[model samples]
Target: MVKKKFRYDVGILFISAVVLFVTGLGISQGTPQKKNPPFEIDRFIPVETCADCHSEIYEQWENSMHSLSHTDPIYNRVAKFLRQGLIDNDEIEEAESCVKCHTPVGFVSGFPTRLSDDLTKTPEIATRGIQCDYCHSATSVTKMYNNGLVLKPGHGEDDPGIKRGPRDDAQPDFHDAQYSKLHTESGICGTCHNVKHVVFGTDLETTYTEWENSPYNSPDPEKRVTCQGCHMYQRPGIPATGSTERPKNPGAATDYSDERPHIYTHYFVGANVAVPAMFGDEEKSNMARERLKNAATIDVDIDPADKKQIHVTVSNTGAGHSIPTGLGNLRQVWVEIIARDRGGKTTYEKGVLDAGSELPEDAWMFRTVLGDGKGNPVINIAKAREVLSDTRIKAGEQMRQTFDMGFVPRKGTTITARLLYRGAPQKLLKQIPGEPIEPQPVVEMAKAVRTF
Candidate 1:
């Protein structure tokens, strides 16, 4: 709670400074200096500082994937393996590569630290993990070979040298206010959200690229939706509480089409509940769970007379990228179904990974497994040679699966069934496998359902 308050306080002051700078309202009368401010403008304004006056917004953000960008255990492990490869091959320095996104502030401050830097120890800096200032401070982006974010700290909001954001509320208790165009576009997010491999340049992570080619980004002018349209909206529960600036829908079509009177949310929520839970943030994990629940639909089907055939459908009603898109080799999504008879005996089961084990046998999860020239699965990132197979669910696509089983229903009764969807499947293993293992069969996506 103290962290939250401190973050908000920082956010308030930073935002005020930005607004005043951009609006040219708080410029001290003096000769224009040729050099930029001496403050470490490159450092990100940690999240906790934004929690002071914007407590609500801070809470929402603390629950988002953005807040956990550097702390996710799975990501941390994968990065370690990759970094070791870089170090052994003498390709890059140890802290230089990972700190780009994980500890932008530390990198900016010239502190050579590992991803293990405790944000709690440096509460202000920790809160800035992929934080408000880090993003808003970006002056321009040069998308060349890798995910390069050209930084001109204190550039946005007229060189405020403080926190920058999208808000229009009247808060005289804080710094000045100013509106910025960068805050409204997806380009700002593309800075870090998009990732590319330095060695192969094969585009390991390309959420922004996928969005650019998506129907949502139609350039036809008549049919198009910005990334913000889907991710941020008055979708019954996701507008920014601190922002007074509403969305301007030039093509207003409904009563809800009017300006929202506030900016979209900064939670930057996604379908990664397991990670936050692992980080000791139960509230954040729960929020991720709710967001995932609200993002899709599930259905189950089984013939009454013919109990052998069971069909399930999962629809990607939400999520702009391909379901289970990024870090495909690491991230996993699958559906588990269990059928029971009147006596509560299990008739059939699917998608169950043994406790504290790797992915279950024949689990129909969404992911991409890399392989070597020998046509075998390759787990070691350092040894990975090429792509093997990818079975991810596409946006707006419904995945269906049919299972044949022999479970007779009770006389004049139906069998009870339950279907579960999980985000990460191979989370238990501390290290990845060395050899190719038997991969699971892919069932189209599966939804939830019950029999009468």
Candidate 2:
């Protein structure tokens, strides 16, 4: 009996040692150490306070998706749907997971599972969504992927260690500014952008990983581009704080200095026109449309041997990550092809929107499909247990689709190919009944024409 017990004890010690070694290795390689802690409400200064000096930047942020993430009616409705339909049905953990990124302030304040139907009832800071303080106050990230940010709240303007930003030379009179290299890297953005299922442990969003694996993340400076480079266009401007006429680089004594060309604007533009349009911000909606137009390019080719055979090529040229990067399960991107004769009669059409705003059965969609444990399609990401398939176009990559034109008229025909993007799938929108679902507009990313 004593000998058997000693052997068992030895086996337990070996298993413990292996676990310790693996854990230490994970820490060395920057795996997430722990979950995010509760936010300190008092440490959060209102965005209006920062706007006192950074009016221009504040305006830009006010028009961004980050600003409207929480207050958007569609997002609120979805949260409610998840809560009432799923969380109330015993899937409480998954519902809480979404709040970590969507409403980090609320999630950290110990209200992760609750989302009020009335916007006024929601916490003020939570309504701010991905606000400035929640990002600037981050001391470090526990990992590069997933929501593993470690925040160290700053106690208002008088606090010694205020906010950390990219500029090392910035010296604002109102608050302390320290240089943070992490802010300049893509990993910081990855802290919140990359999301994994809280219950199933499946990756739901892999925007950062897609960028990391692409040539855009190359070590060559000329070939490399950070998330901020494209999203935040740079221009010669005064400091975000202080007077508009103030110098771009203000000295310790003076409020302004000579102009510098490296001031990165805070537009934070992405392919999100629907939310801005819903919020009644035409300028931001237009900006989003323009950004989408510049994100990709399309090429069309016809086979010489078989005039009926056509090849359409779509390339994700401008974006550093995949063309339809974040929330792939919800976002929809596809190619719309139409061929017409000289009389303007339609010869062939694919990806046409039906009367109900639904894509045709033959539409080639670039998205990720999720499935439940039973292998059935799952609309709510919280219930997803497996990634059935992902057919998105990667950064600096091209995808070609071959289509049979069938019998074409003897006269020359014009074929038009357009890359289209939608913020959310129509099926998902239909799930939220009785909210007067507005028709989500589809933005054209790129277009090409070919005559045969």
Task: Summarize candidate 1's per-residue lDDT along 1-452 as a digit string, tens digits.
Answer: 43663564466447434533532432321111123332353344445544655565566566467776666656665665554544432123222356556665555554424444444454346434676666656554444212345555553333345334465442323334445555665656665665543332234556776666566555454545555665555222442111112243232211232343444555565555566666677765554455555445677777666877777777666656666766676666777777765666766777765765455768766677776447897654444545677776666567888777665555433333333344444442444445422222222223454654
Candidate 1 C-alpha error for residue 297, in Å: 2.3
Q: Give the TM-score of candidate 2.
A: 0.85
**lDDT comparing candidate 2 with the true structure:** 0.71
Off by over 4 Å in 1: 1-55, 71-74, 81-96, 113-127, 144-146, 155-159, 162-180, 219-225, 233-260, 277-280, 303-307, 355-358, 380-385, 406-423, 426-447, 450-452
On the 0 to 100 scale, the lDDT of residue 91 in model 1 is 26
TM-score of each: 0.68, 0.85
Measured over all alpha carbons after superposition, the RMSD of each candidate to the real structure, in angstroms, is: 12.2, 9.0
Model 1 whole-model lDDT (C-alpha atoms): 0.52
Per-residue error (Å), model 2, residue 372: 1.0
Strongest candidate by lDDT: 2
Q: Give the lowest summed-lDDT range of ten residues in model 1.
A: 26-35
